[model samples]
Target chain A: MMQQERTKVILGVIGADCHAVGNKILEHVITAAGYEVVNLGVLVPQEDFVNAAIETDAKAILVASLYGHGEIDCRGLRGRCEEAGIGDILLYVGGNLVVGKTDFHEVKEKFLEMGYNRVYEPGVLLERVIEDLQQDLQERGLSRD
Target chain B: MELKNKKWTHDQFYAIRGEVLNQWPTGAAVDFAEAVKYHENIPAKKHFAKQLVKAKKNGRTLTQPRAGVALINEHINLLNFLRTEGEADLLPTTIDSYTRQNQYAEAENGIEESKRAGRSLLNGFPAVNHGVAGVRKVIESVNGPLQVRHGTPDARLLGEITLAGGYTAYEGGGISYNIPYAKSVSLEKTIYDWQYCDRLVGIYAEHGIEINREPFGPLTGTLVPPSVSHAVAIIEGILAAEQGVKNITLGYGQCGNLFQDIAAIKALEQLAEEYLNNHGYPDCVLTTVFHQWMGGFPQDEAKAFGVISWGAAAAALAKATKVIVKTPHEALGIPTKEANAQGLKTTRQLINMLADQPFPLSIEVQSEIDIIKAETRCILDKVYELGNGDFAQGTVAAFAAGVLDVPFAPSRYTLNKILPARDNHGAVRLFDIGNLPFTQDIIDFHQAKMNERAKAEGRNASFQMVIDDIYAISKGRLVGRPH
Candidate 1:
């Protein structure tokens, strides 16, 4: 059997949010699920995510905001990624994105509007994020395994 | 920039007000005089200050839940549900993040998008985006007092819009909102911004409108020692009072130790009154709000209810003027409205059951109270000394010198030098005092407390203990001991 190349992805909690537990858990889960994760720790800025994406040639940038300020930090990230010439890069964000009790569908729609390819709700199963990533990458013809 | 205890002059306030009102379109709609008129017409029952005063006099602990969504109608419906279903005594319109960051444009887009989708796109009520008219619609729909609960360091616009919209209470202070919530907000800047908020309240208070002001208590909501949070609340309360705020509700986050929780509340109310009186604000009405456990919750709903009920019992026993309830779905992301209601129901049941019970005054409880008071005095005296008797100035310098510290806080402005761990009895004690100015005896007290826990666990008092304690409650243990 031909050896398959590992799918690389960048993961982090973004922008002044130091929620390490979830980031650690996500990295472990994704790693165990057979993906190479470039864990950027916490408090990651937008440029750092983009730079890491280009540096690692990662297929996706998974952003987590556990402190309810995701919309501000994740806003215009897609545009910024495009400016960095990574427009087609898969963008995912979730976790208490806004401060108040917003509907998940509305949160999802807002992220989609902001150019995120997928937005996970807080407490969303890790397997779902992985399954969706696999399907999305396969659809984009980026899968090696 | 000198952090003195001086109220802003009308001209100075107007100069800042001009720029503030221009921050967003809603700013222009906030006619202070018109807002005053609207407030005057609002019934006494809907006034937060009046309700709080009544609760304090009656010795009843009011319950308030955190709930907000994007659309105005939905947010109103949610608050109404909390009022009827959750049995909340006070309601909160938690501001959305975009508005908290002053990103009114994005918040505006969120509101419109929410309307188009027939669902709330924003996480909060987007009070600024809603402006006065929209917020007034919410105020009109709600049956009781509504507060604007948000963690905005620069809440000048929010304060203006919400107060104008008939919100009777506003939660947050410069340090409380800044140190825990933001990463890079300077102490100097947040104090100044919060002065604007207090001054806005002052402006209303001057017009014979009593608005309740609360400082974000439970700083970082980790294993914060009582004295640490107490010192901050007293400072923020004095700051609010200096700005002419007559009604102050200082808050403390539940530390998961019952005796310590009761002691902290009693100490907070006593110290606030003492400090305000010494500062010549004899008229300042002091109240206490006990926030339910603000740290990690168990993933299980039943376990989460245990945490909520524990907090409720503590709040009731402490005779706190109000309790900020948490939902059973806390470990999860923002709770559904139903979950929020469930949390309030749990809290209501616990408080009501314990309502007839008086807080027991035991020898141990008395000692904890005395120790907490002494430690708080040490911290506050150092802060006052640092500011040369100016609380605001001292606060800035205190954080700069690490004389005051909050552990696990994200703000670079906070010293983050203090490390806290539960004692043998699960009371939060300082594991690392850092630059906190404490007497040698107080320092020894904390050390001895930790030593007792360490000896029991057969381990040295170390950072590992702090880490364990952080997750202990989630694991159904208070003291995180190694196997």
Candidate 2:
């Protein structure tokens, strides 16, 4: 019998966003929960995400942007990923991702429309990402259990 | 930051090491490269040795990002934000100088408006300066080896000023504050108004004390370059002229801190040379603290700990009048009593080590001062830009437009957002000054762990509750605006 593919995720803050306090915390919890994670550090551009995914054959890309300018700075990232031929890679994002004050549902909807498979509002704890990852992996027939 | 001393131990060393290993692994270590040619040395103290050996065998790199992207990039982003938001319509100095350059009426009105906003400046200071009793207790606690001249009459009245320079440094205190003919405002009762200042200068001859004057001197033109920091020095000059007080200390921010600009060094130079000129009383100490605005960038706590300790040591080499070192975990949040105690004791050790090491200032250091002065003056210019015209919500709008050149804003993705990222280059060069005071004697993280152990044993340890309260009470609007 052929061995099944493993669930793996690549995560980082994208575009010109450089905040890392939250990024480090997320990395810690994600690793502890037993998913294989490739953390690309902060200020990753669109191409870096696509390149890392292609290089590592990652199943998803998780983006964190705390500077609040994620809307303007990160709008084209998903499209860039698709162009690099990894359109199927799942995308998850959270943290204080938009500038000024706004509703989180609206933000999630906007990012989802832009092609993210999963979107989290600011202060969405690390475990939520883990649960979503596990569920997604289960559906894909790749859960460790 | 604990206020007392501490020692290092194997278990504590291993504990912080395990945490470090969780991230750097043996194969992912990055930022500590050149400085830590002794990665082997990093793990030597006790438990860390095994981890380091394992990491070395596995080819671990510490995975620290480049400087601008994560470290010094905040400056350029701020600068760009300033440029894009647009320049200030009027220089505060021009208003102070009575130069109605262009749109003179607008300038005149702006000057008037700033004068009205005088109350806004003291956000934490009590509106009424009535807290001299508490201040007197603090003053009494302050001990100095220097004794005053015989027959120096008891001090009757005292005064202190904010010396608000422009930009991030002084902020509107210069031109509007230190007006040459500023009305001689009395202070005996405004302690409630400026309570945060905790400033006290005098007692009104009989019963109560007064801590008067909040003038911000703008020492422009031939006398000296009017950098925001220089404004504080100039104000000190004026304060020294008062005869009532026997001693004074400019309890300024970063007084016990370190920076690329060597700001404390310059402040000391100004104080030493100009104290007598202002006819200030003898024995005013210029103490500094262990603070860094950059620590918030969220690098490894261990590295931050080392940098702050080394920084104060360097500041002392510049011959600090006095110093205060913060505890290692301070950046995590407000320190507990134990943390404060540790911070004090750590600084005491660093100071003791540097005691015999006399500092010699040279033309080279002078050049660094000139560069930093110009750079921050440029920072002031950017701050002025954002003041009037940015259509966006303060800094947020400025960043979206890519008009900001400084990287003060910490985005979630620091790796690409900062260095080689165009606007952040200058900031890297500026902060590089901090790494210059190289030392082999300082055993890096393990040393800190050792000191921490000693501190905990001595009951001087503190655990700071790391505040994750990123939620703005104004619900994320600019402060003072009703949500």
Candidate 3:
């Protein structure tokens, strides 16, 4: 029997963040759930994500920032994605996203306004992410076999 | 370069010293002959190795806290406060991140900015930027013995400046510092660089100044198995002994399981001694340091103290030579001095109360120690075999082949094959053993433990357990039970 092609996803820690544990865990969880994850490890630039998304035609880009500098690192990232011609690609951001104890609702609203399709708080289980990914990919008509 | 576990000749070390001392302008201030004379003048009470030996002899667990600031006077004042208010038996000059990365110009700017702002903008003291004289001023002002603590992959320059300035103990190792701290640094390069740091300590030992050399034992402190850490600690201990370091302190981070934590310290001390003795370093005086929990803490201060006190209790019961204290403001960024003192006093209270009490060698702890020793032996034997009996080469090869993998490390060199999750009783067990050179019985033990937890949770043994365990402590529980 011919093997089915795996759905591709782009994942990395954004900006100067060097928190690789969560990023690596996310990659393992996502890949095990049957996606081909191009994990650009820690300290990744914004362009690298867009470039990888473009190069692999990834269905989604998962951005993680744990250094509490995600706000500054993630600014204008949506615009960069749009400029790179993958404007509609699903974007998910998570982790200790802000510098201090900000309300999760406020943080989520801010990321949504900045073009992320989903924003998760720190400690959100990866299984929940897989479920979200399944539903979102289905809604976008990018479902896998 | 073909790296061997051989000691560097005096000529080779001196040849490299010239280049190392030329790396920054501060390095020029390091006058070895003059530095030796200054070290000789440091009071016996302020000697780190001497204090550790005395503590070990008396069966006391000394307390130490990690503290540092940008400016010299402020740093000295902070150390004095910790010594007096916190009752910290040992003080640390934690190096700033820029200095750890060897960015002296950036660290210099941080110093200027901190001075103008009347506060430290840097996370730690920039000892290299301060040079030997600045370090000496802080050293002279502090009452207790001082240690230079930082997670630097290349600490050659920092070692030179700090040692010349009279700091008696230095922390970090090639494998320990690089695997956990750096994202892209190769193990070979770090192990090679750290050899220089160890050799510098060796030179001090040769001069009858027994500066303590500690291998940072908690590699990627996130749920690391005791065996993995023990293996790395033993390798580093052997490596340091080979370089002529006489006083060595191997350390372990608390794993949250009281029995396992105590057993880890015991196993580490025993394994380190065995490895060092077998490797022909019988004269080396070995000591053990237990680091308080290195994972995420509850944001609430009250809850944070609970975590700190638990660590303190474990350290005390384990009879660690010293316990590295953690502040109550761990979850928050850069704790205030008051909170730091509170953490220390809380720890000291526990240590004092538990001092006369003895922890019985229960079967649980003894079994944990036995298993850890067995697992550590497997890894070390593989490492020795891989290096064709050379630990330095074996360490690099072990990481390359995934035989000695650290869980959740940032380094690209680590295969990232292993996954760790706490068992039903909160003991760390490998959910996925990866390529760790474990025998079938060992693998079966971990698999059985993981299966037991899976059965209890009504869930299959999966990666979710790993994720849950990572956030367990912050959420106020040892095991991440499903709600």
Tens digit per residue, CA lDDT, model 1, B1-483: 565767887787888898888888888898888889999998988888889999999999999998888888899899999999999999999887667777788778878877886766566788987889999999999998999998887999888888988899999998988887776679889999999899889989999999999999987788889999999999999889888999999999999889999988998888889988998789998889999998878878899999999999999999999999999878766787899999999999999999999977787788989999999999999999999989989999999899988887767787777888999999999989999899999999989988898899899997667867877887777778898
Candidate with the greatest lDDT versus the true structure: 3
- TM-scores of chain B alone in all candidate structures, in the order given: 0.98, 0.34, 0.99
Question: For candidate 1, lDDT tens digit of each residue in A39-88?
Answer: 88666789999999999899999999986667667999999999999999
lDDT (10s digit) by residue, model 3, range A1-145: 1224888899998865566777877888888888899999877789999999999989999999775556656778899998989899999998877644557899899899999999998767688999999999998888874
What is the descending DockQ order? 3, 1, 2
Candidate 1 docks with a DockQ of: 0.17
In order, the interface RMSDs are 4.6, 16.7, 4.0
Cα shift from native, residue B156, model 1 (Å): 0.6
True contacts kept of each: 0.12, 0.04, 0.18
Docking class of 2: incorrect
lDDT of 2: 0.35
Q: Is the docking of candidate 3 incorrect, acceptable, medium or high quality?
A: incorrect
Q: What are the lDDT scores of the predictions, listed in order?
A: 0.87, 0.35, 0.88
Off by over 4 Å in 3: A1-18, A26-38, A43-145
